[model samples]
Every structure is written in structure tokens, then in C-alpha cells.
Target: MLTGYQVAVIGGDARQLEIIRRLNEWDATVYLAGFDQLKEGFTEAIDLDFDSDQVERLDAIILPVAGTDDQGRVDGIFTNRLLHLTESWLKRTPSHCQIYTGISNDYFTQLTSHINRNLIPLMDRDDVAIFNSIPTVEGTIMMVIQHTDFTIHGSKVVVLGLGRVGTGLARTFAQLGAHVSVGVRSSASAARVYEMGLTPLDMNNLAEEMPECDIILNTVPAPVVQAAVIKQLPSHAVIIDLASKPGGTDFRYAEKRGIKAMLAPGLPGIVAPKTAGRIIADVISRLLKNSNREVDGS
Candidate 1:
């Protein structure tokens, strides 16, 4: 029940609060860093300052979903004070201490290499990503329904990239009676798309097929939908780019062409914060349990 472990939860938004609540229910001693902005009255959590000296005492460190930015700044919405995660902080963590984050960035990678410590990305876990896909798909569908005049039934939906999110989106759209098409890079993925009863097209052929789509959902991280692709699409087509910042679609080109384009990242947190937090807490608690088992075994 995480009774003996000291967990330090660093800054995050509403989702973080849910995690804290769940941790408290599990009877974990949680030290909150940079949570001054959090409303008072969390019974089992202690809000502490961001100091390197505290790093040595923790059994585990939990960062936000985005981990850290390129500049090594962790997400801390509660405090105005900037907590920079430096290599020194990593070095100060005890040898057995584990680090957890949602996603890794350049700064995190650098720290991992420099400190020789294992950094587990909760978002990268297969079970977590699979569970998170439900909210993501539901949120994407909600956005499409909200923005479009036409119903998903009989709408032409094109999903770019066959990753977890894209696959879930395609299935959901198709199940809702939309004519779904999936754009993929490999022939194998194309075959899989066809086997799933969705039309499969090469990403390179997006321009040729763009005109048929009423909704284009892009999961690709790069700029796949440029001016050329946007020009081929019908004016009524809505583009949803689900990639991270600087999303896959060319925003300027879409604006110029009058195509409605949206970049929707972190759909789970937006649409279902409590559910998302629960998913994270479940996975993290399992991880902590397994870690404790290993310690006992050794």
C-alpha cells in the first residue's frame, strides 16, 4: 500500500491533484514539491519546497505527464517559482530510487544518460497507453461532432498514422458508420487497415485522396498535411491534429485554405481528468509494488 515508501510528487495541473488523492487513499506518504497553489486541506500530503537536499530522502520521484521541457523546467502550475531539474538533482537521488514521468524530452534523456539512473515513462507503458486511448478516442469523436454540422454517420473520415490513437480513432469512427480510411507508411500496416474493414492508403497518396475526406484526423508528429495536401481537400473538411506541439498539419496553409484545423493534445486530461489520473495511479502503484517486491527478493 506504499506505506514504507516516500513519494515526492512534483508539479502538475488538475490531473496531478487526482493522482495525489489516489496516492493518499493508498496510504503513501506523499511530499508535494511546488504545490503552493494547490488548495489547502490535503490530509496526507506535505507541500515542500524544491530543493536538491530533499531529493536524497525520497524513494521515488514523479514528474508531470510532459516530464520536462527542453530547458529542464518541470510543469509546476501551483508555484510561480521555477524548479529546474538539473543533472545534479538526478545525481542526488539515492541509487535505488526510481524516477517516473509521463513522457521524456531532450532534457530528460540527457539527465538519464548523465546520471545512469532508470527513468520510467508511464505514458510509454503499453497498458497505460491502451487504457488512455479510450478517452482520447472519445474526446476526438466529441470534437468532431461538436465542430461539424454533418453527423458521423455517412461521413468520410481519414485517420493519418496507424498508431494506437489513430487505430482507435479509425475503429470508433467506422463503428459510428463513418466511411473510414487510414493512411499508413508501411504495406503491412496498410494490409492491417484493410483487414480491419477500413480503406487503406499510402501517406504519400494523401493529396490524391484528400478530396474524399470530410474529417481528417492526423496522429503523425511531423507536418504531413502541408499546403499541397490542404489544397486538394474539400473546403468543408475538418482537420484534427492529435500530435504534440507544432502538430502534424500545416496550420498556416490550413488557415489560408479556409480548412478548419485543430491541434488537440492531451485529450484524456482535457475530457476525463479523473479517469486519466486513476489510470496513471493504477499503473504507478503496480510499478511501486513490483519495485518493492524486487527489493524484498534481493
Candidate 2:
């Protein structure tokens, strides 16, 4: 249990609600920073603004999945008010205070480094990524169904990158009766794709497969699907770039060719916030419990 522990959940969407629920169940004293628009209230959680002097007393500070932007502006789905995680505010926190975010950026890393504070990126953990893949694949399938005119069965699908999400998507699509081809950077990944009874293509030769691809799912963060690649795709082809913002696909080129191209990031949160939140809450509680025990020398 997180009894007596003071945690500040800064800003987030619906998933934050489940995180708050888990924290309250553990008996943590949660301070909410940017939830003014939320109607629900927790028995143990208190709504507090960023300017509150009490913010410095936190044992842990949890930011949204996206965390702060390049300018330190925190994303708050619950509030219209601008929230920023300033360096001064961070520096004032207790020496033992740890900050937890889904992903870290230059602003977070540099500021935390200069302040000598610990920052945990939850998405960096393997368990979190693997668990997240389930919802991502489901959401991808949903989107494909909604947008495409034809059935997934007998469709030609190509998945870029053999990472957690890519692997799950490729296998699931293949199981659904689609001919799945995975694009991998390394030969070993290709071998694994073949072992899974799926076709494997070199990332460099991705264009060769584009003309026949009915659905293209890109998990690679780099610009692997350029104008040259999009030029070879059929006009009816749909490209779902699941990479981070400004995804791997050439959106402009795809548009010029009249191909359906979409950039979808954070599909897990959009499609299944409850499940995603539970995954986050489970990992976070474990970390907090371990940390609490260490502090008490237990």
C-alpha cells in the first residue's frame, strides 16, 4: 500500500482517472494539478494548482503520458488553463522526490540532470511496451475496418519494424487471414518473421512490396516510407503510420498520390484508456512500493 505517500498527478486524459483510482486504493495522498474540468472527486485525492506551495512536498510527481512539450508546457485534457513544469518548481521538490512520465524529452532530461533529480520513463520498460501492443493492434484493426472498403481477409498487409507493436500487428493480421509481410532492419528479425510463418522484407526494399500492399502499418520512427515508396503504392492503398508525431510515412506525398495516409500515435489511450491506465498503475505501484521499502530499509 502507498499509505502516507504523497503523489502529484499533473495532467492527463481519461487514463489518469484509473491511475488516481489505483493510488487512492493504495491509500496514497494524491495531489491533482490540472483536473479542473473533471467532475469526479476522490476521497483521498485533492485538486491542487501548479502554483500551490504544497507541490514541493511530493514524494513522486506523475506527469501525463506525453509529459511536457519542448517548452515545458504540460498537456492537460481536463483543464484549459496552461500548466508548466518549471525548473524552479522542480528544484524545490524534496531531494528524494522522483518524477515519473511515460516518455522523456530533451527538456525533461536536461532539467532533471541539472537539478540532480530522478526521472522515470514508464514506456521505456519492456513490460509496459509489450502490454501496450495489445490495445495498439486492436485500435489499428478497428481503424482499418472503418476506413477500408474491402475485408481484411485476403488483403495484403505490410508492417514496418519488428518491434513489440509491429510483431503483434503482423502476427494478428496474418492470423486474421491477411498475407502479412514485415519489414525489418536486421536479418535476424527477418528470420524471426519467417519462423512465425510470415513474409519478411528488408526495410530498404520496402518500396518493392508497396504496390501490392492493401494496408501498410509503419512502426518505424524514421522516414522509411518516402515519396519514392509512396509513388509505387496503389491509389486504393491505406497507410497507417503508428510511429510518433510526424510519422515515418510521407504524408504530403501520399496526399498528392491520393493514398489514404494517417498518423496515429497513442492508440492505446484512445482505444482502451482503462486497460492502458491499469497497466501503468500496476507498474507504478510496484515501483513506488519498492522505493518506499528501500527508504524504510525494509
Candidate 3:
């Protein structure tokens, strides 16, 4: 049990509640920050401020999935006040204090490096990404239904990137009778796409494949469906860019072309927060438990 271990849960969305609850159940002394307005009823944890003393006592610092933006400002949906993770703040924490976040930015990485603290990016892990693909596919299907008038059955769908989300979503679309075509850059991935019984197209040939597709889902973080690719697609085509910020599609061109384009980053959190929370909470609890063992030298 984490009876004497102190954990500070910083800004986050609905999923943070699950983490707090799980940590509390494990007997950790928890501090909630950047979440003053949150209606979290976890009695074992304390709703606290960003006091320096608290930071020094913290064994672990939990940050949001998105972590800090380019400017090092965290996304605090629970409170109106801005939550910033600065270099000075890390300096206040103890030497062994480690930070946990889902995904991080270059700015936040630099700060953690300077402080010589362990910055764990959970989303980068295989198990987390694979499990996350379930809700992500479900959320994508929801978006496909809401945005498009056409049925999934017998519709031409192209999924860019044969990665975790792309592969899962493509298989689902194919199972639903949508003619699923996967786009990939690597020959090995293309061979795997063929083995899955889905048509695979190289990213270079996307312009040729664009016009026939009724719906285009891009999982690639890079600019794959820009001006050239957009020009190739039918004006009535639907685009769902699931990449992080500034997604893969050209928003300006899509708008000008009168095509429907959606940039959905954290689909799992939005569509199935409870399930997503549980997934994260399970991983976090195990990590903290292991860390506790390490501290106890057991």
C-alpha cells in the first residue's frame, strides 16, 4: 500500500477522476491541483493548491494526457485558472520525484530534462495504444455516421496509416461491408494490409485513390491529405483526420473545397471516457505500486 507515498494529480479531463480514485484505493496520500472546480468525490484525496511545500513532498506528479502545450500551459478543463508547468516548479519537487503524462511536447521534455526527472509518456507504450484503439475505432465510427449521409455498407473507405488505430478502424469498416482501402508508405505494412484482405495503396498513389473514396480517415500525423490530395478527392468526400494537433489534412483547402473535414485528437476520451479512464487507471495503479515496492526496497 502507498500509505506514506504522496502523489500530486495535476490538470486533466474526466479520466483523471479514475486515476485519483484508483490511487486513493491503493492508500496513497493524494493532492489534487488545477482541479478546484472538479466535483470529484474521492474522499481519500485532498483538493489542494500549488504550494511549494506540497511539491517538495510529492513522490510523483501526474499530468494530463495532452501534458503541456507548446507554451508549457496544461489543459485544465476542471478550473478556469491556467495551469502552467514551468522549470521552477520542477526544481521545487524532490530529486526522486517522477512525472507521469500520456503524451508530451518538446517544451515540456526540455524542462523535465533540465530537472533530471523521469517523464513517463504512457501513450507511447504498446499496451496502452493497442487497448486505446478500441474506443478510438468506436469514436471514429460515430463520427462517420454523424457526418456522412451514405451508409457504411458497400461504401468506399480509405484509411491512411496502417498503425494501431488505422488497422483496427479499417478492419471494422471492412467487416461492416465498406470497401476498405489502407494507405501506407512501407512495403512491409502494405503486405500486412494485403494479408488482412484489405486493398493497400502507397501514400504516393493517394492522389489516384482519392476520387473513388467516399470517406478518408487519416491516422498519419504528417500532412498526407493537403492541397494536392484534397484536389483529387470528390467535393462531397468526408475526411476524418485522427492525428494530434494540426492533423494530416489541409483544413483551409478542405473548407474552400466545401468538403467535410474533422480533426479528432482524443477520440477515446470524448466517446467513452469511463472505459478510457479505466484503461489508464489500471496501468497507472500498477506503475505506482511497482514504484512503491522500489521505494520500500522490497
Each model's C-alpha lDDT?
0.84, 0.88, 0.85
Which regions of candidate 1 fall more than 4 Å away from where they truly are? Answer: 292-298
Error of 2 at 46 (Å): 0.9
* Clashes within 3 Å, all models in order: 0, 0, 0
| C-alpha TM-scores of all predictions | 0.94, 0.95, 0.94
TM-score of 2: 0.95
Each model's RMSD to truth, in Å? 1.8, 1.6, 1.8
Error of 1 at 26 (Å): 1.2
Clashes by residue pair, model 1:
none
Error of 3 at 23 (Å): 1.5
Descending-lDDT candidate ranking: 2, 3, 1
Q: What is the lDDT, from 0 to 100, of the residue 15 in candidate 3?
A: 78
Off by over 4 Å in 3: 209-211, 292-298
TM-score for candidate 1, residues paired by index: 0.94
Local error of candidate 2 at 192, Å? Answer: 0.7
